[model samples]
Target chain A: MDYRARFLVDPLKKLSLADIDPDDTGDIDKEKAAELTATYLQRMEEDQFLLYADGRQSLLVVLQALDAAGKDGVIRHVFSAMNPQGTRVHGFKQPTPLESAHDFLWRAHAHVPAAGEVVIFNRSHYEDVLVVRVHDLVPREVWSQRYEKINAFEHLLAENGTRILKFFLHISPEEQLERFKKRLDDPRRHWKISESDYSERKFWPQYIEAYEEALVKTSTLTAPWYVIPANHKWFRNLAISQIISETLDEMGLELPPTRVNIDEIKAHYHAAVKATENKKSD
Target chain B: MDYRARFLVDPLKKLSLADIDPDDTGDIDKEKAAELTATYLQRMEEDQFLLYADGRQSLLVVLQALDAAGKDGVIRHVFSAMNPQGTRVHGFKQPTPLESAHDFLWRAHAHVPAAGEVVIFNRSHYEDVLVVRVHDLVPREVWSQRYEKINAFEHLLAENGTRILKFFLHISPEEQLERFKKRLDDPRRHWKISESDYSERKFWPQYIEAYEEALVKTSTLTAPWYVIPANHKWFRNLAISQIISETLDEMGLELPPTRVNIDEIKAHYHAAVKATENKKSD
Candidate 1:
């Protein structure tokens, strides 16, 4: 299956989360999926190196998921093979007093990737529409207006050479409950199980509705959203890895052409080396 | 020699550019210097990886130099081995119309490195004091106050997690003329030779004085200035690589402690793998 076309949210089509099967793995067996995922991971690393060497464009990966939909797991498994020097992961939590004082996008804007870099947002400005609307953190009118603002913000980034990929990790409520149970049962995972994880599960339907609207409204041709069926952790990793690797491959990255004559530079390098060698004898 | 201490500007003492020899190489032969620089570069790479994994502190390297004083060469030689993904180079030229509309530091503040990253400014907020003062681009009173503003700005970055290193690559007027001649002689290098190269030469003394004051006033203990003798390109690279390696070493970076129990995480990993295997069989 062409996962990019299969999972990409069609703006014209109504975005109903119910239509997508959270457990679907495209009929690929676990071994095949893992093998494919490893290949993609290796390709992604090579593509990232070319992207950095080209030094002209940037990649921004935005990951949005429910509390137990495996956002952290996806990041670790997919990006661990890539160089940390070029990749950054920013996790947006609740706003601080200072952060709240500014506009909603101010904090996120400060961390966008520069040329030849990849930045991943564990959660992002979409929170302004998601949590802020679902929990009445802000009034309806204010949150409603933010879709345009968010779109404009992304447009500005796109215009300035940022390629954005947003993923909504779609998982069933039953799967979330099972993951939460696992966290509760494992002593090591106990720290990750919070009171809000339980309390927030009650708002599951409303949260899905909020996300559906956001995915519909903000996913543009330049910055598209991929709805990944994340109930199966291996498949989620496989799908995301494939999308990212393919996207980077399509970017047509090449090492920047040399601006100076390499022969001349080589000559100077040799002369300089000789001069240093002569100085050593002194 | 302790390059960090030897090259660090002493704030209490009067600074005289004429007193520092631009050709000094600490009596090290070129072969030995190159060998040392290569070692430092490797260490810097390792330290940067640890710094990113540690994810607590950041390093901001501010490079300031007169035209033809070898800032580009220093960056190319010293930092080429480091991962370009974790490192960013922001070269501040004349301010854009939008940039000039705001306060001087407004544009620069936007690009300061975040935690676990290294950002190198080819020219920076110091331009407000150096060029703005030397060229009389702003009124005397306006440019004079910027030293304090610049100091406070760096102080704010320091209070956060950023460790700042500012380098003033000091080259003599004779060396500048020599480099300008080399550029004119080589067609490949002609693109870098601007008309301003000659026009700016007239302001040499004024620029030196402007830089001296900025260096003295803004060189706090947290963000100190290093005056490097840059007439010889290889020596400049050696000094810079050594200083940076030592500074990162002093930062004491370590991989962050795991928040979860490794035994439980390992057990879960095995269980998850088994689940996938079982599903594949089914």
Candidate 2:
């Protein structure tokens, strides 16, 4: 099945968390998924090189998930393969006091990918809709109207040559509890488990409702959301990598055209090289 | 010779451009330099990973150079090997009108690397002293006082956990001319060769004088300058890579400690994973 077609949140239709299976891997075995992921990663690296050389388009990957939904793993395993020079990752934690002074999107806007760059946001302005709504951190009238605001912001990015991919890592509640337990099992991973994970699980249904509205409202043709089945970690990585690779490939990036007269420059360069060699030998 | 020790600007001693040989490679052939550079780059990647994991210290590399002195090349070749998740590059171009309204350091301060990241400045606040002085864009009285302001600004960053490495890519006038000619001769590189290249060559003596004063006045214990001999591109890459690798290695980074009870968490996690498996099988 075409993951983009299967996974993309159709803007015209309403989205529901129950319609997608978190554990689904489209019948592929673990090994095949891994092999496919590697292939997509290699293609991603080549596409990114052309993107950087072309110095025009930008890519922004927004990963949104409940705690323990593999946002960090997806970043480390998938996006790390690209050149560090052209890729950046910004993790939006709870907003600091200074950040809160401005509108929620202010901080996010500052780190949007520049031309010829790829930026990954571990969590992004969407938090204003998700967490802020779930916890009643902001008033309803304000949070209620953010759907259009976010769509407008993303439309602005799209108009300015940025390709955005938002992934709602759809993990089952049972899987999240299982993962949280694993963090407890491994001493080194304990830092990742928090009190909020257990407390937040109580609001799972509300969280899902919030996400459904977000995915349905903001998933436009230009900046789409992919509802990845993220219970199987390897499969999640595979699906996300495949979608990104295809998107970048479709960009049809080419090395920017040379602006100077090549023959004249080549002759001058050769003569300069010869002159340097003579000076060295002398 | 220790490249750090060899290239470090002595704080007490006045620097003279005539005293340093831009073409010197410290007796190493191009092949040996390349091998050494690769070794340092590998070490740099490992150290940067630890730094990111530790999430403690940040490193800010400030690259200052005359036009065609290889600032872009140095950033592309030397710093691209690290994880993009933990690295950022900000090129300070001619200030936009908004940026020009602020004090020179304001724009630079906004982009300093956060804890556990490395940021490279393609050109930095030092330009306020170098170019602003050489061109007399600002009065001598105004630009003259900026050296102290820069030192104070860097002192504040050092106190706040940023380790700074500033490199003045020291190239001879002849080499700058040669590089500009090469850019003119290569169609792909023509965008780099500008009218400024020819016009700026006229200020070679003034730029050197500006640089010598900036180095002598601002080189401090926390944020020192390295005057790199940049005519030999291979040697330049090798030296800068070695210094950065060694500096990060000396930081003694360790993975952050777990914040929760490991033994308790582990038992809970095991039970959860087992419950998940049973649910799947059922």
Candidate 3:
């Protein structure tokens, strides 16, 4: 199945978040996803090497989700397959006074991928239209215009050879509550629990509204947004890995041509061998 | 005389660099400019204090010029009046390997002003359109589209509370030759000379055409471009300083209201003084 077409936010057709079931695992079972993910991860690793070697193109993977939607899980399970040298992750939190001083995009623009680089935005510029809007951080007019600004920004990146892939991790409210309960029950996961985890849950409906609008408005040919079924963590990993590996394949990553003459190097190697033989005779 | 009106590139009318004589110093003489500059600098110094205290707006001054057009001179003579803490200057040189990997505007965008800050681009993103176009560094199709990109970038800056003032320091080829000769004749200025200085002079007409097109295409109400005649160094300083000071004045840079009560603080000061008096008596 073409995961890109399956998960891509349809622009012509108005999408309501309620219509897409987070619990839907499609035809793939957890066992099948576990088996398939390994193959996808293997291809992704090899493809990443070619991407780094090519050193002309870039990839920006943006992940947007509600609280406890398993954004980090996707990164750890999926992105960790690739070499860390060329891959970077930026997680957006509350803006600093210095960051707030400039335009909203200032901080994000600083961390964009360079040539032969892969950058992941754990939560990205979409937050300006998502959290910033849901919480009333700015006026409605201010946040409303950001949809175009974001599209323009992404367009700028796209035109400059940065392939953009955005994923909205869709999780049912029940799944989020379970995840929060798990965090409370487990000491290893205790650090992940925050006051915001519970407090922000109240804004779920507003967040859904904000996110749906941002996805539909900003989705374009160059930078596309995919809504991942994140209720099942294994399924989320499988779907995301499939989409990314396919995208990397589409990048046409190939090693650059070498200018060195191989025959001349072989002659030098023979000459060195002869010299060693001459020294032994002497 | 409104220096803003005097030098602003009229967008409705076609602008030819040849028609604007570089030697035209208007009614200002060296002695008069020297006096008027001191007054402008005083107001500017005070205004910058209010701006920094207000901490909401920002200023970005872009200087675009040919070789020996004295971009550094403006920074040294005029901008030196403001406190170094709030003011910064970025001189755009040849792009580094990493910088070249990204878009042309990427490097420039990284250094845009934060709130209540003053940033001066010695030679700015315009080089992408000017030098990049003149020398055919990129295809005409590629360089041609950069005008709209640059305008969009400036608009982004403008709408985000950054006041953009771009000055194209107009200098004649003869004046540039004379300046280059001065660099050779004076040992103190020998470090400023480069092979590109003389070689670049060969493309004077092409440079003018590139500049004319860039100015016309990019000149906007929010971010206006001024063609400052730069044959007379003092006149250039006088005109630029006049324009900057007037703009800053119009920004209505009032200090943010103090949240503390001065009378309560004064009462505590008096009580502390009385305690000190009692201690002396003991």
Candidate 4:
């Protein structure tokens, strides 16, 4: 099997950042990475509001990662500069009874970005294929067909004026264990770790296999997944920020012409004062 | 007419730091006011997320104010420390065609805060009564009944579990002109001003009348309105922060217990490591 298919059977435990040869090929310095990431994030924030004022297009950011691989941190740090007015971030946890009753896409569909706004899904519709497939939560046949369903769903969104950016944070099993333990020892971080996280770790191989297959089948031009190496947090943030800034810049949105008329305002203020004075005399 | 009814005839405006007779009355120092507000806000941010994690009550903050009365500044500054995870801010603008078709409360209902979360409405359901009444956009008969409708709607939310805090920033008409001109004079501040602001000033008497009536009719014990004196930003922020912190503290929400068994986690980690070794040997 190729690298994509190999990942499916490739138990998540087998893939550690230590296993990858950093010096052999592609990597950047952490400090440089953080600076670049912050700069690009600032630009993305300004551009997001500019696009909103222009009322041209909507944006959807989809983040998928293994447990403890920095999805929450990415959301907090990457888009913190953006105006809350035009941004909505939704973290999709386990499905609720209300959500589970609908089609797999129903909950996600409800969160689609409106025009001139940016919406983020911390984890999204891909869960139908990944988690549902790994845990046998759905029939094998049912989960198998969802790849095409997801592709069609995303294509529909893209055609209807939503630009989608999907990220797959690729981290090795050793790095994940280090993160999992870090969560346990640190009181501030303990809230994030759960029994479910451990339960899922047991089926790491199955999840890896599922993700590999999902990536190839769903990575279309309309919505491509940029797999970021997640051993280094700074590098991961920089890569994602650059991709987001580049994507919005490609969309060519401009700030709206919203200048005020000074003379008219001054005239109105004087009139209000005169009216108030006459009322006082009365 | 009582104060509530009379305020409707003229609505509240800013009472600037210089204008307020500090020497004559019981006024807190400006520095002390700023510190109290900032500290209260920080505490609220901490307590809010803990409550959210524990899945307790929901919080809805409704801010109703005249133009140039510091709504944006309040949002940007007061809630600046809150974690975006448990906080959502919605700035309601002119009604869309779909929104206009529904009853005034319908649009607001869609954005209600969920359990353990806080939602801020920069301007809210009251707009149906205030702006619509001022502009004659809706028939008097239609807009007139909204006060009772709003009170009932908020009451229902309180019964279900939401704590509502409604604030009216009371500013004088004279101060509004100063703030409007300041926006024009500062290049960075230009985006904050709009043409509709001047046009709206023309109907000040009408709006004042609408707000006074609404406040008198709808300020219930369940979701009471705080008439925040708007002349000083520090004082306004301090008052809001104090109110929010007091409300949450009364609820007594604490962080959830981190009770994962250490032996179980160690066992799990070992299993994960063994799986990795086995995969490598394969």
Candidates ranked, most accurate by DockQ first: 4, 2, 1, 3
Shift in Å, residue A31, candidate 4: 4.4
TM-score per candidate: 0.58, 0.83, 0.51, 0.81
lDDT of 1 by residue, B51-138 (tens): 7777789999999999989887776677665655457677798999999999999999999998989888889999999898888899
Residue B29's lDDT within candidate 2 is 94
State the lDDT of candidate 2 residue by residue for B74-162, as single tens digits. Answer: 87688767766778888888999999999999999999999989999888999899888887889989999998999999999999889
lDDT of 1 at B39: 96
Backbone clashes in model 2, listed as residue pairs: A181-B269, A184-B265, A184-B266, A185-B266, A265-B185
With candidate 1 superimposed using the best TM-score fit, by how many Å does residue A266's alpha carbon deviate from the native? 25
- CA lDDT of each prediction against the hidden true structure: 0.85, 0.86, 0.83, 0.75
Q: Individual DockQ of the candidates?
A: 0.06, 0.29, 0.01, 0.32
Best candidate, TM-score: 2
**TM-score of chain A by itself in each prediction:** 0.95, 0.96, 0.95, 0.83
lDDT of 1 at B250: 93
Best by DockQ: 4
Positional deviation of residue A62's Cα in model 3 after best superposition, in angstroms: 40
Model 1, global lDDT: 0.85
lDDT of 2: 0.86
Model 4, span A1-282: residue lDDT tens: 022222221222333433443122134576766777778888897788677877768899999988988887787778666666677888898899999999999999998988899888999999999888887899998998998899899999999889998887778777888788777677775665678878877777787788777877787778876566677777667777888887888887876554766667667667866877897899
* Higher-ranked by DockQ: 1 or 3: 1
* Regions of candidate 3 where Cα sits further than 4 Å from its true position: A1-282
Best by lDDT: 2
- Which is the winner by TM-score between candidate 2 and candidate 3? 2
lDDT of 3 by residue, A1-282 (tens): 777889999877788999999997978888988999999999988887788778889999999999889887787678767654466667798998999999999999998998888888989888899889988999999999998898899899988889999999999877776676565555444433455666687688899988889899988999999999889999999999999999999998887654334445335434544654686699
